[model samples]
Target: MTTTQNQDTLERLREDYPGWRIWRSRRGTRPAGWVATSLTPQDGRAPTLHADTAEELELQLKNPPMGIGLDIPGQLEWSGGR
Candidate 1:
């Protein structure tokens, strides 16, 4: 029963994927949902994945989609080495 709203589940996702910031989106303007952004310093083309639930997000993290790249505005840093 690992609901997306569960803090423990979120924490585990964070631990499992360090370089990506896993969280249930409750940010300004953005609709509430699951989000993970690759923070590793790249050419601002880090991959940012989104899902409806934490479970799906974790799966995406485990196996990112092909051609999943985004030109981030600035130098993003993360550490979620496989």
Candidate 2:
């Protein structure tokens, strides 16, 4: 996808999942992947997902039963912050 489209998707995910923290690399750092994390419902332990690309994140968003209420733009906003 185009850079603009990818950025929009990331922003949506951040708005959708407010509780989850998103991380991205700074200048000169390796573009490892995107990380979404939250406290476990059962024990309050941290649970996280690593997505290497926008496509993977989009797939996760499409599947709602996965328990993450993520939208594309939110994720983009979060990533852009970093």
Candidate 1: pairs in clash: 19-79, 19-80, 39-77, 39-78, 44-72
Report model 1's TM-score to 2 decimal places. 0.60
Worst 10 residues of 1 by lDDT: 66-75
Would you list the C-alpha lDDT of every candidate in the order shown? 0.73, 0.56
Q: Tell me, what's the RMSD of every candidate?
A: 10.8, 14.8
- For candidate 2, report its TM-score: 0.45
The top-ranked prediction according to TM-score is 1
Off by over 4 Å in 1: 1-5, 27-31, 41-46, 68-82
lDDT of 1: 0.73
After superposition, the stretches of candidate 2 with alpha carbons farther than 4 Å from their true spots are 1-7, 25-28, 39-46, 61-82
RMSD over all Cα atoms, model 2: 14.8
- Kindly list the per-residue Cα lDDT of model 2 for residues 24-67, writing each as its tens digit: 43346445566666544332233566677756754554442343
